[model samples]
Target: MRELKYLNKYLFKYKWHFLLGTIFVIISNIFQIIPAMLVRDAINYVVDNLNIYQSLGQSATQQKFFTVVAFGIMVFAGLIVLMAFLRGVFLYFVRQTLIVMSRLIEYDLKNEIFEHYQSLPLSFYRRNNTGDLMNRISEDVSRVRMYLGPAIMYGLTLITLFMMLIPFMFHKSATLSWYALSPMPFLALSIFYVNNIVERRSEKIQEHQSRLSTFVQEAFSGIRVLKSFNREAQSMEKFDRELDDYKKQSLKLTKIQSMFYPVIMALIGVSTILTVYAGSMEVINGNLKLGVIAEFIMYVNILTWPVTSLGWTSSLVQRAEASQKRINEFLKTKTNIVSEKDLVREINGKVEFKNVTFIYPDSGIKALKDISFTIAPGESLAIIGTTGSGKSTVSSLVSRLYDTRGGEVLIDDLPIADYNLTSLRKQIGYVPQDVFLFSDTVANNIAFGTVDSDQSKIEQAAKDADVYHNIMEFAAGFETRVGERGITLSGGQKQRVSIARAIVREPKILILDDALSAVDTKTENNILNSMKRIMRGRTTIIISHRVSSAKLANKIIVLVDGSIVEQGTHESLIGREGVYKDLYEKQVLQEAEEKTS
Candidate 1:
């Protein structure tokens, strides 16, 4: 019942269709019961009218009696066939309405979940795996639809038939109806017992399935790394372990589910036996007519099917309940970042971090502490640091990827949190250290940042990134498809294309986080030369380890241990004999050694 609360809106949205479908179910069942009554009437007519030959030894009287009985039998048979046909027609409409409604709901639910997924903060994705989320949206949603469609449909059928048949059964013979229904209490208890076991096992099965899916997705994504390290055997062993676990869990659930049928069949079998034996005794003792006995059997048979179907319907309900719980929990997650009521529509490219501190949610370790800096509009500032010195974290904070723990991050004299997330992000273009290019044409990937951009602009951006010539060398040129993660291109090519993607946006604030690490020295110099003209009116923040890259900035900051240990021009920093000087000398020596070798 708790799990079903999440589905209430969809159910209510389509309540009219469900109501009409339920009416069809009731009407169909009403038609379905008429044939049994007709059978009993025909049998009684045959038995009573055939006694004409015994009473009057006239052939003419016997012929008339036989003719009347035959005519009555034909009429009953015709009505039975007509009733069966009508029942089938109503059942068809029932399925068309309710089953189709389930599909409609499924479509809407999938879109809602996907939209919610898009709106969630980045921290939520970090804590959750891709495969588990996929399973929840795909498999769990389908299970819920099954519950809404077939489970509810048949459940209503059983209820309506049970209510209608009880009084009718008593009408034929009260004593016989009691005997036939003796096993019902035990059947209900057994269904209750099985349902509990099924629900628990179903939850475990779904959990194991999510783990298995995550393992496969991660393995396939990292296949190149595994093969390079020659660890295929180790990976295969791990996969086999996961597979075995999944199989064991699935079989355990199957074993429990398989118990449903035989138990139900046994209970229903007992009821049938009692009905026949006790009914036969009533006929012989003259307490009940044979026709009434036959009618009683028909009623028990009608009840038999609904009782037996209880197992299947209960299983569907239990599984759906388990799945709904998982989905509802996911939907209830609160986004860590949100826009304030006073939303700023734009920024003037001036950025500041005032006594900012940040801790990663997963590690709970401070990535930055008391960091303060300012970049004036149209000015270029370079950040140089060793690994883990919070260089990239500074860039992420500028974009408001993660909210600051302690101080204010402002853009254009307003706190960053005061701006709408989308509007704020639209003003900044960031290129991360790990460049990701989608599987698409070079033109499309370059234009990804700016939707519906013209071809001329895309070409100009590619030329600015200094990859236009290399792109032309390909067979399809800009139309060539870059495979997954741009695997078809070299590392330098991927990096340049990613830079072009950022450039095409023509942002007010451009962040390059080790964006030139993969290119050669000459190419890097060329890219920097091109960027100088482009960076004239744009605020640029370059985070790099290379001295050549950092030296081009108007001002340089050297960070060590999440704090700025030095801030000056390259020449000033070199004269001070600080960390930046040491880095410059080392790189100079390494380049000289490489040339000599």
Candidate 2:
């Protein structure tokens, strides 16, 4: 219930809609009750007039009386029809305002959650699964919307009907009204008891739904791997097992929810019986008119639908509470990686790491240990290391993807945190080892980072990355669509296209983290030659294990177990008997052996 209070701000945002909807509820109910009163008066008028006409015994006066009675009945019927029509119109307005406002809030809430997801650091994604994150924004929000739209609408209708109808019932006959409403307290108790169980079952159902969604999403994403392993039958078995569990939970909820309407109808039956019995006794005693009994029955019937809806509206509210609690859990999380300063400054790409040490938050492994380095503006530095030697970590720190645990990372002589986060990232073009591409055309993928990139600029970047010829050979040329994660292209082609994406950005700092690993030596050399032109005045850091790529850098550093072992020019490092020289010699032998074979 407390979690539901978060929606109050959204409600306030669309206050006028709610206010108008409330007015409509009141007016519609008024019109609804007026028809019942007219029915009561019409019944009494017919009873009174019948006796007079019979006493006149078919005279001219009796015939005149019959004419007047028919006219009166027609007028009453016309008025009743008009009231019903107006009530329906106001009800339509109620739906337009309240339900439409809920949709608007749903739109705003989803956008807000997605924007927050984008602002969160990379480590947050590592901590949470993609399925759960998606569930919160989609399925969970839909449940909350039920609370916003249908539950609120029905709840308001019930209140308005009760306030208007109950008092009139009492005014007609206190004793009879008491008998008619005697079952209400019992109904209230039943609802209270069922609400708790409904809430618990709803939470379980939501959890299972998220699990099912995650399983399906992962299974589809890795369909190629599943088929290669011939695990389709196994996957189907797992899905069936989960589906059975979900079915059982849903059935339990439905069994309980099914109890609502029967109980409401039974109670309403009891009210009807009591009202008839008491009202008939009053009429027999000449204390009340017989027409009043019909009026009481109509009132009870009018209240019937709203009373029965109590269980449904309560269930909606309980489910919404459960879903909103899940949503708030993520919305409350504050990202640690945020810019301390708002000032935007141009980056000159003088990146420096002073006594920097970093540990991965998700897996508390220290990736960098008191490492120190500096790459002056317009210089090229290549970091060479074996797997898990903190080579990629260096590139991430340069991009400020993660903050250091015990030291400072500076850009242009200012702490990285001082610059605006967006501004800093915009000036750096990074091509990661594991490349990902959206389902879009090849030209669009290359021009992804540059907002104003034309077709010529995209083609130029593709040629510079040595992927132009391959793209031109495609059936659609640069217009060819790369499937999910660029599955339409080969490994080397994907790597080159990613390089083209970075090249098009024309950033001040370019970090290539093993971006050319998938290409052969010939293609690698061609890309390196093209990069030499692009890297002329940019601060570049090339992270790779191959000596052919490392030799192009102005300076080379060898990283071993998160510590710098050697730092010098490529020629100087090769002359030394250290980690760098050993790596270079091994690569040289491997290449020679390949040629001989």
Candidate 3:
């Protein structure tokens, strides 16, 4: 019951519905008890008539006796039918109000969790898998619904029945009721034990399910690699291993549940036998009437279903408690980055990194260390670096994808943290090395960053990215669907589409991290030439390994091992005997050698 406390907010939201549904539940239970009482009354009437018939002997006509018995039975049956009908009506509304409320709450919870997931920083996604989060939001949420809806409703029914039946039973025959209910305390203890085991097993089952979902998602996403490597059998074997674990856990839970039924029924069986034996002895000793004994038996029968349901309801409660705890743990996670109060909402694209340092959340090694640089508004700077030289890290910081640990990332001379997160991100356009495109139309993919981008704007961005001609070649042009992650398109096509997406936003800062690496030098040169107008009055940062690309920038910086080693114009760097000079000479020689070959 304490586990249900988390649902207080939702319950309060739908308080009126619950109140009406509770009234229905109470009325239905009350009506249900009437039929049993009617049965006792019917039996008593038959007994009284029998005694009168015995007294009348020869004077009582056969038809008259038959008429009296039929009349009494008919009256009782009519009352029973009327009560049952009333109960059904109330039960219908109980389901309508309570069950529907649960669904509404489920809808709210699912949307809330998804919104929170979106609000979380990128580091959170890096540490968690999609499948595990999916399982929590789907399966775990459904489990909580069971507790909120059916469990609460049925638990209330059982409690109401107990309150009504017990006192009546004691009034009829306290001795018999005492003897019959002696097994209840033991039954309760058993239920307690069962619930504990159920809670533990339910958690394990959910965990296994999460692991299985993750495995399948990863395998399917990487199916191309598995096929190329000819590792189908290996993948199948791993999947089978996880499947076997899931099967074993499921069976263990079933085995525990199976043991519950017999233990419960057997105790109930013992109580029934004792009540009958004691009542018969009392009748023989003239301490109780036969009709009273029959009524008590009917009451015991009514108790059977609710008592049996105790095991099931407890199981629902235990599982829900476990799932709620898991949901709470996820909701408690604090985002690593948070925007400050009263922050600026506009950006001028004057970017500066003042002695910044950053390390990944999990990794102890620093990604960028004591780095410092500034790019004025409307200026383009190219960063050339070897693998892991912190080139991409600089682009990430400009967009505030990550926050600096040691120093400040400033936009328009204010710390980046002093701007609203939404405003800052809206001002910068970032294109990463690996581009992700949804399974949507080409036009939609290009216009993804903006809400109201029209056809002309999409085409203009596409033309600037040097992809408009290629798109026109497609069967349906911009309307054609790109497959998952733009898999149907070539690497160069995907990169161009991604560039178009960023350009359509008309952002103040554009950061391209190896974005043009997939295209040929001719296409790269053409795209850069076309981007001149778009890049005007906006800061642009190009991170690339190619000297051909870097030579066109207003300024160029060479990085090695997380620090800048050289900074100058291409001609000035070529004049020096340093890293930039070596890189330039190698690329020029490689091109000439390739042409000769």
Best by TM-score: 2
In the range 1-597, model 1's lDDT, one tens digit per residue, is 689788889989999879998999899999988888888788777777767646766678777877777888899999989999999999999999899889989999999899899888778888898878988899899999989999989898899998888888887778898999999878867876887787777778767777787788788888899899999899889989988988898898899879887987887778878888888899899887667666766776777667656766887887789889999988898776887855857667998989988888877878787988888999999999988988998898888788998999988888888888888888888888999999999999999967768999899989999999999999999999999999899999999999998888999999999999999888998899999987889999999988889877889998887888899888899998789999999999998987788
Sort all candidates by lDDT, best to worst: 2, 1, 3
As for TM-score, the candidate ahead, 1 or 2, is 2
For all candidates in order, the CA lDDT equals 0.87, 0.89, 0.85
Candidate 3 overall Cα lDDT vs. reference?
0.85
Give residue 356's lDDT in candidate 1 (0 to 100): 87
Per-residue lDDT of 322-360 in model 2, one digit per residue for the tens? 889998998888888788986597788898989999899
- Show the colliding residue pairs in model 1: none
lDDT value for model 1: 0.87
- Taking all chains together, each candidate's TM-score versus the true structure is 0.88, 0.93, 0.90
Better of 1 and 3 by TM-score: 3
Backbone clashes under 3 angstroms, per model: 0, 0, 0
Q: For model 2, how big is the CA root-mean-square deviation?
A: 2.4
TM-score of candidate 3 versus the correct structure, residues matched by position = 0.90
Candidate 2 pairs with clashing backbones: none
* lDDT per residue (tens digit) for residues 185-260 in model 3: 6776686677668667867997888789889988899999999999999999999999999999999899887877
